[model samples]
Target: MAKRRITQETFDDAVRENMEEFEMNPEDALRDAVEQFESQGVDLTCIVKAVPAVSSDDKQEEQTHEVLKALDSLRIGKDSAAVADVTADMKCFTEQCSVGFAQRYLAAQKDAYPTILSYCKKSVEEQDSVLTALSALAALTDGQPDLLDAEGQQFLLDVLKKHQADSSVTCVAICVVRHCCLKHEQNRQDLVKGGLLPLLTRAITQHSGCAELIKQASSALRVMTFDDDVRVTFGNAHEHAKMIVLEHNGLKILIDSATAHPNNTSVLSELCATLARLAVRNEFCQDICDLGGLKLIMTLLADSYESAVVYNNNNKELVRQVLSAIRAIAGNDDVKDAVVSAGGVELIVIAMNRHMTNPTVCEQGCACLSVLALRKPNNCKAIMENGGAFAAVQAMKAHSDAINVQKQACMLLRNLVARMHNYSQPILEMGAEVLIAQAVQTHQDCGDVGKAALRDLGCQVELRELWTGKHGSLAN
Candidate 1:
């Protein structure tokens, strides 16, 4: 049976009922409410699950929650508010918004978007309040991308332009840009046109030593390359990505940044992911190689293997990002040979084996091998000899529910035998056919690629004919 669900208000009311009517304490009430809901198979992950605390007052004034109180403190009845007042109000709103999604949502419902945006506009001329205002705006738009409209986009770009030299301000400003452009296509395009790319790349170059600033700027640059807005038919993601690489010299900047911060896993991971996003063309792929990106990536991948015994989340994420970078840069035919020669194939197999439980790592590992095996018979030989094929099949078996893993495994198996048909029997011996068939049956997105893999492996595939007759006969 499907699990039941409840709204945050309903769950909070139940907790409040236990506390008020039954004379239970807050902790006991919350615990009882949780136990009761979960016992009935209700999901409470979205519920705040905490009793709202009201502010104390000397008089008999109405009680208000923390977020509401913080929001109310921002409405000063003056054209030119004091700097201290503005700073204090901004800090309070930022603190409340940073607590959780519930606070941010409540503030948004109370029309916090325009209120905070007004402060952003007002702070444009007041450099003293730039950081705090930008920080508050960043927090307010964390999961609320729709709050960013044309005016907010202009404000963010203005902040980036004004505070380009100040790493502290640029860091928070770029964070705001990242939040706004995350899933908003128009905002991304407008900001990019407003010269956000140059500011972001410049921030990285000027603040190479500042790990936090570099990480935030790198993430913002990557956000520009995303095509995530679902309402539009197409976005300028490819154009933005190429602009970052070609016009802004993004490849060399990121590579140099990674070289500078070799020991910082988080910064390196962001740099690597951004590099993967910017490698849109064949020459760009080669540019990464010529800029010494391959050696840097290989070194990072090797270093990650050393910490395999005490594998943690950061290590897992770093490995995933590095492998994705390798997969993306290997799109070039010459780079494919280079990767195989540099022991990349073996390292990928080991990464898959080490982080076997992580579906994302497995997905990237299989995808890296798939790219390496494309049209290169010698690389295919290297993969199978180094247990790449076996590891991919194992990843498929282990992460059967991961559609990306299944798809990449099928692509890798097909790429293995596409040029070197002799490798088909060996791969099929590892049960590739069964997994591909299962993927085809389970995931609708995996139908074409999975069946192609099976067909190449000499397994029977029932090719369906959805229509017959001339090409444009349906129009008639």
Candidate 2:
């Protein structure tokens, strides 16, 4: 990526080198750096103030400091009269008038947070001015969400709810809430209580045409779904990404978004992830199947795999979620038949080969095959015909270090061999026994893998014995 035109004051020269070294763009690098700094209690507000005076190398040293507090503060020139004028006429929030005053007040005035929240409430109708205030609030409170007291957090959420119609205002509002909720447990709780999830989902569905707005809303929804409670809530609505999203027919909205913006890979990738998360529960399986979930996900799977090797704009994230969601959906008997009939098993094996080195996809692919293999009497035969058994064993051998792959590989083979048919020959040709023995030895610490590996070996041995008993064994 080319260099982003950051203001010289806010831009660190060495950050460019760090970006190259980390193989990330400017935005991701800065976000990561800020997160690392925040974790160590570093007062970024002070660092921003001290950047001009400090050397780059010395500043680099400061990044690793064990202790950081607001020991330095930005100097301010705003008088009380200017602040009073802005308070009286909300339009004065332009340029540095509002931003500068906010910086000064945050640094010097103890009552800065309360006063700013009240000021924002005054001109909430001024979308542009409210955005400016939110920006200032983010700068002041990114490293310390506590500064955005209960009232401030509520005000920010309210800002999002009120301006859901105005994409620009809601975009900034979403950014403000995301910043506040960055690693702040209390703030996330406040958001959940403030009805952030449903409101954001509504905004996403209502504003599907607005790319930037959908991007921000989906990003925030993804962040909030990190909580287990939130995941369960999302899993409740049949096929909906989250519980809150279902309130506005979020699933249909997702399908509509996918249909309308087929080329928007970013939004689609995020949507895939949300779907994967919601597919965790068994109740959601039939709903997803009925809604053409298998067919939709299969398209993404093929596209992600083909795009990964051939295109620069491949969405690996979409691949990961497609695999995971398939694993969840395939767990159900009905969805399993639907997936197999749609040639989903073959696509899964292809994806595993395509992303052999991707541990996440490899693991999920093996698990999905296991579900497919055990789905019905015909499934094992179908998997063997599609060469899924060999593909699974190959994945296990290739990604031996991935415990999940090992466990799921053992599972798929076990399910296939339970029928004790043509699966054994293909599996053994792929040296399934050797890999299972290795898993048993290598993953002794991982009880699930080791135990499954042992059980599979026993099943294969019994199968060989039965084959020999049925027909005279000829070494030839």
Task: Name the regions of candidate 2 deviating beyond 4 angstroms.
Answer: 1-123, 133-149, 176-189, 228-242, 305-313, 419-422, 459-476
Where does candidate 1 clash, by residue pair?
none
lDDT of 2 by residue, 112-137 (tens): 45545554676587776676556555
Task: List TM-score per model, in order.
Answer: 0.88, 0.67
Error in Å for residue 346 of model 2: 1.3
Give the winner by lDDT: 1
By summed lDDT, the worst window of 10 consecutive residues in model 2 runs over 66-75
Error of 1 at 6 (Å): 11
- Name the 10 consecutive residues with the lowest summed lDDT in model 1: 75-84
Q: For residues 88-120, what per-residue lDDT tens digits would candidate 1 score against the true structure?
A: 667878998898877787788778888877777
What are the clash counts of all predictions, listed in order? 0, 2
Tell me which residue pairs clash in candidate 2.
234-242, 234-243
